[model samples]
Target: MHDHAHGIRQGDNRRLLAVSLAITGVVLVVQVAGAILTGSLALLADAAHMLTDAAALVIALVASAVAARPADDRRTYGYQRAEVLGALVNAVVLIALSVGIVVEAVSRLLAPEPAPVAGGWMLAVAVVGLLANMLAAWLLRHAQKHSMNVRGAYLEVIGDMIGSAAVIVAAIVILLTGWTRVDAIASLLIAVFIVPRAIGLLREVFSVLSESAPAGTAVADIRTHLLRTPGVRDVHDVHVWQLTRGAPVFTAHVVVEQEVLERGSGALLTRMQGCLAEHFDVAHSTFQLEAAGHEEREHH
Candidate 1:
């Protein structure tokens, strides 16, 4: 039953990500066309933002497929890290694009250009972009909660949505007040929306790659919990990290109670695994069980 449910979940994720990629691709094209036709800096920035989102969706689809591969001799941990690598790459791309947009917006501000289309028409396209972004966000919402790959894509869609809204507002202001500077301000606002998100995502990606402790799951706190469990004496050489987006893997050297070690080491290990799973949500764990006489204190 569990295996069947797991298979169904995997199928659902693949289908959803594929559909998201298709939608993002179509929206990116439309946004780019709208930008060119309207000659609106705001529209162009939003189009660029959607372009990054489309790229993220494509990377996520490929990364998910790679992550499903079985463990091999060269990679004993399997290909799960592909998802993290995908996120890291996406973050780098976003940073680059954000920098480019900021530079262009600054240049345009110094030397303003007339918008080709009337503000009302540009506003109409911005509305369409906004709707497209919302739809994309909904498609990836569930997956984002569980997977970093989806989260990266979700962030891009969210940033694009904000960019679209900013463009719409700028268009309205341009129409009402004849403020050509509004387009440059909107472009800068789009960069403001993107840069911070890109920086945060890059930090997460590097943390995962560096095997830093998973956020919100402190190593000392986990050790203390394990020590309180039955049959556990001392814990050492402990380490924890995310195996994938949601799954965490842990390893520790555990000194068992003399009686428990004498009776059944295998049973003690099994009990410890259960305890770790129940308390810490650690899905995979490796505990080196040590008997009392053979145990020696070790520091991390």
Candidate 2:
């Protein structure tokens, strides 16, 4: 496979992760303290989500650093897949925390507790958290489009941002009506928000690990494109998979007419590679040129 040449900023990613992680750590402490003082389940759940954000940022930072290493003889693909693993772990953690938050929120809803809450403290702490998560989310927004590793971190931060908003609203409701169940309701909202995103992230990571073709690609369409090229008789064993997010790799066997093989296969190879790159943006691909029906002999 050739290089797909995706644009990845390892240095910038690390810096963003570091800043986000530190800020999240601070927010976690602040929110946790606020949760205890205010007895706001929304604040508590947001704190828990912030905790996962910190871990995800750490993982993403390490993964980005590892992924930047040059390829070696032993590790031909370099360390790109490390980022995928980090993203996978981040998703799993988010899923776990989301479930726990949902269960706790449901329990609180069932048996409303007359918990004393300092609405002011919850609001103050959550406002700070909202700012931090918003900044972190901004840093990761562009990177998330092209990098699964960064997307994992971004999702965590965005989730916390939503949680912060929930906390703020819960604080307002509690202050106005003295209703404690609103806190549980806010936590449930955060949990509900987290589920679909966490599941989406997991699906992405799973797709990478399972070597599934990138989304929005049609194998049949690709085959048809290849067959339209001159000197190409058929295409078989076509496979496409992502090495990392935004880096798709392809391999295929192209059957050619005997005359084309006798003349030269260089032009056909060039055209095949060009078609894949032009149409599918698949720069990294391997093509095997074979005489028409050559696979029959191999099967025999």
Candidate 3:
């Protein structure tokens, strides 16, 4: 039953990512042409950002598909970790793109005679790009909450939106005051917006890859909860981690009264599993019920 629901969600994620990728690809082509026609650094920077976003979306799409594969003999947990790896790649690409944009912006600012920028053309193109980004963001907003791969694509679209806005502002200022350096300044601002978000995403990807417990879940709290179960005397060797976003796995050795163990463990197991699912949002759990003093006998 859980597998059925998860498969549906994966299908939804892939559809959303595919639509967003199409939108971004169209915007990338438009922005590239706009930048060439307008000679605006802001537009060019936005185009470059979109280029990377399109690539990121492709990676996310592939990862989502791979993650949907069922577990096999060799790969017990399936390919869910593929999504995390995809997100990690997206973060690195974003950081590198931001650094490149910053370097170019600085060079443009230092130049004595800046390139001519056509304000009207830049404004028209930027507005179009902004509207496209908004559509893509709306599509991914809900899915991003549940999947790291979707979130990576969503963040890149958001950054593109900001870059478009910066380009529009630069165009307006150029039209009003004829200060072309604002175009370079706008590019710098876009780069600044990208780095922090990418770094934060990178941190989350690392946490998942390192097999750390899901955010906001404490192992100690899980141990305490398990110990409270009827017939459960103690809990040890408790382990909690995630296969992917929203997919937590838990395992623990539960010490129960000797009489309870001798009688049966079925009812106790159901109760403990229910407790974990209700309190900790952990649907996949394994508990080994043991007689008291069992831990003392086992070699570590």
The 0-to-1 C-alpha lDDT of every candidate, in the order given, reads 0.80, 0.87, 0.90
Measured with C-alpha atoms, the lDDT of residue 280 in candidate 1 is 72
Q: What's the lDDT for residue 107 in model 2? A: 88
lDDT of 1 by residue, 1-300 (tens): 001011214456678888877877887788788888878888888988888888898898888888778778999777778888888888999989988888988887777455444677679889988998898899888888767877888999999999999999999998998887788789999998888898898888888887877788878888898888788878988988775577677888888878886787776676677777777777688888776555554331
Tens-digit lDDT track of model 3 for 126-238: 99999999999999999998899889999999999999999999999999999999999999999999999999999899888888999999899888888888888989888
lDDT digits (tens) for residues 195-246 of candidate 2:
8998998898889899999999899999999999988888888899987887
Tell me each candidate's TM-score.
0.92, 0.91, 0.95
RMSD of 1: 3.1
Highest lDDT against the true fold, candidate: 3
TM-score of 2: 0.91
Measured with C-alpha atoms, the lDDT of residue 93 in candidate 1 is 91
Task: Tell me the spans in candidate 2 whose CA falls farther than 4 Å from its real position.
Answer: none
Question: On a 0 to 100 scale, what is the lDDT of residue 279 in model 2?
Answer: 97
* Model 3 misplaced stretches (Cα beyond 4 Å): 1-8
Candidate 3 to truth, TM: 0.95
Clash counts for all predictions = 0, 0, 0
Candidate 1 wrong stretches, greater than 4 Å:
1-10, 112-117, 297-300
RMSD of each: 3.1, 2.1, 2.0
